[model samples]
Target: MNGGILHALLEFAFYYPLVMSLIWMSGGIIYFLRWERREPSRVRPRPLPDYPMVTLVVPCHNEGAQVRETIAHLASQQYPNFEIIAINDGSTDDTGAQLDQLMDQYPALRVIHMSSNQGKAMGLRAAALASRADFLVCGDGDALLDDYATHWMMMHMLESPRVAAVTGNPRIRNRSTLLGKLQVGEFSSIIGLIKRAQRVYGRIFTVSGVIACFRKSALHDVGYWNTDMVTEDIDVSWRLQMRHWEIRYEPNALCWILMPETVRGLWKQRLRWAQGGSEVLLRYTTRLFKWRQRRMWPVAFEYVMSLLWSYTMSVIILLWVLGCFMPLPPSLYVDTLLPQWHGVVLGAICLLQFLISLLVDRRYETRIGRNYYWMIWYPLVYWLLNTATSVVALPKAIMKRRGTRAIWVSPDRGLR
Candidate 1:
């Protein structure tokens, strides 16, 4: 690469994140002021004129240790007129038996035993077909849903017929290790801010797969979740939006869940996420040029830019590593590897972004600031992890054949 080109790419690597941080910070603040401040019941569920029948769909695969607690939480929902449906997606463990025992305990609890392992998408499709309710709250088997979460999500669904889904806030439950602790900050500072900002930008890229409420009609209209997609949540989000349905983000709806504390586990999870995103972009980019799809233009464009940024960073890192072993052009050596004023500015911006997210999210999670010290490692650790995963996962996504069934097994749930 020429010296000028190297300088430009180095500038992009440093400034891209700074620019995005400002966007997220400003957009998140605007969203909170306009939409979140005036809510009447932020902590509890308010009585509605009528409580529509809803089904809580839980997809379980080898969740023997966690299913009991999850079901116990679901049975205690504050919302009225709701039932629990747990689908055992061919678990090799005791997940099926536990759900069967729970079925005997809670009259509202029902269990579906898949003879063989089908993917989460198939499990959800089966449950939706069996469900008698028009609205559905879907969550992971290991997740603990707040008693009032369904009520908050339902408020959005009931308010507008166009609202197809409402994604809840996911809080990390395990923070014993440094990795887990940093992830707590990550979810708040990075994921939470992006969702709020994207909502303000007029379309969400995807709903939280761990916790979200859906309208059955909207799912039907979009042909339900794509069974072959690596991440059904992302695929469904795009399809629903392309069909002109709306998806909202509900910060008040909280779901406490476990994350991968180990580096290998976290890498696997993020790689799947990145590949799913690439698959969605490749599948839908051609369709986004129409006038009706103008609203989604920003989302697609942002994702493309992010992919380019990831590759750019990866190349810089690779060149830097190579230079350490041998000689390189002076321009590449100085601009890419050495710290400068831009580095200081980037660090300051990261801190500001974390502070902004913590302030906006503290309403949902009290004591969120307790994790502030841990966020010091986020910029260095997560940026590299995400960049590497994006670079590696793109090729995998492209190579994946059509009509491949995306299956699942239980992931690392951190230390007990």
Candidate 2:
């Protein structure tokens, strides 16, 4: 084992992410407290006003059988004044024919059939153009939007004119695989917690595309969704906020969505996400300097630090693998992951973070939290996977030429 500089770097590699996670937890708690202090009506009230005409955009590529369930969910939303515009983006399957049949059964539902497959951004944009409503909700064809989700999401937009988009909390539907079960906690511990904290900080890196609500005016102001960005969710979130439209996180607006069930699928999904973040950074560097956009500096700084930590850890791991050829000190080799004091401390930190997030998100559990025991291995797996994904994805994103068409891919959700 080395002392001084090497020791410090090793410590930094372990604790940097831990410290940031703690900060996010604290921020989310603070936000929760503020919400409690506010009036109940202000937090979120029932029987939302006006019942304004709302349009839902269903973007499909090759949605297969699951879209039947998705359309059923849309047809079942409890909201009074809403119309469905389901976009069949040139699916090679019977999705277009299926949608046409569904449309006849549900007259409120209108079908938009694209002759050729473009991408989600184009599909959403086309739906937006056809829509007569000011507010629009977009979701993938596999997601199950709660009957009340539209009401809750609509409330946020009606409450404020500045609110441009409300990102809904997505709950995992498939719990069949170990990977799927692990992600149930992953959403609360990582994605959900970060979103709550980032909202309190006055900036969010991106919206959850799986379930999101948008204002047509805001989309028009930003020129609608950018087709070039691989992740339209990241691109649209940045574009709206840069134009001074607020993006709100609506936890009560629950959308049940499926996630990847294999290491390969999980890796691909995460790499795509990481690459999307890098693309947003590359495309929007100039906007970050504007005086009005200063509030986003903290958000930008956090992302930059995340990348630095990921790359530094990757280099350290490579060196450690090379050092494996030679004999190492017994003390240095002691339980790098557990059984030692530092390992125990780091593990405790991860556990505490998840517990805090779990507390805040308990209301939306939906029979999912019964698998909490699986998350015992969460702290061990989350960072290791993220570091490797970012290491590979960032460089790929950079090398990719700008203006590449953003196509869609169906994630491998382990469901029979």
| Candidate number achieving the greatest lDDT relative to the actual structure | 1
lDDT of each: 0.91, 0.84
* Candidate 2 local lDDT, 133-184, one digit each (tens): 9999999999999888888888889899999999988988888877888898
Candidate 1 lDDT, 1-416, residue by residue in tens:
58888788888998788888898898899889999887743566667767899999999999999999999999999998999999999999999988998888999999999998899999999999999999999999999999999999999998999999999999999999988999999989889999999999999999999999999999999999898999999999999999999999998898999999999999999999999999999989889989999999988988888998999998888878888788988876743555568878888888899999888887787788999988888877888899999999999989999899999856889985
**Model 2 stretches with alpha carbons more than 4 Å out:** 1-5, 36-45, 326-339
Question: What's model 2's overall lDDT?
Answer: 0.84
**Model 1 per-residue lDDT at 233:** 97
- Score candidate 1 by lDDT: 0.91
List candidate 1 stretches off by more than 4 Å. 40-42, 334-338
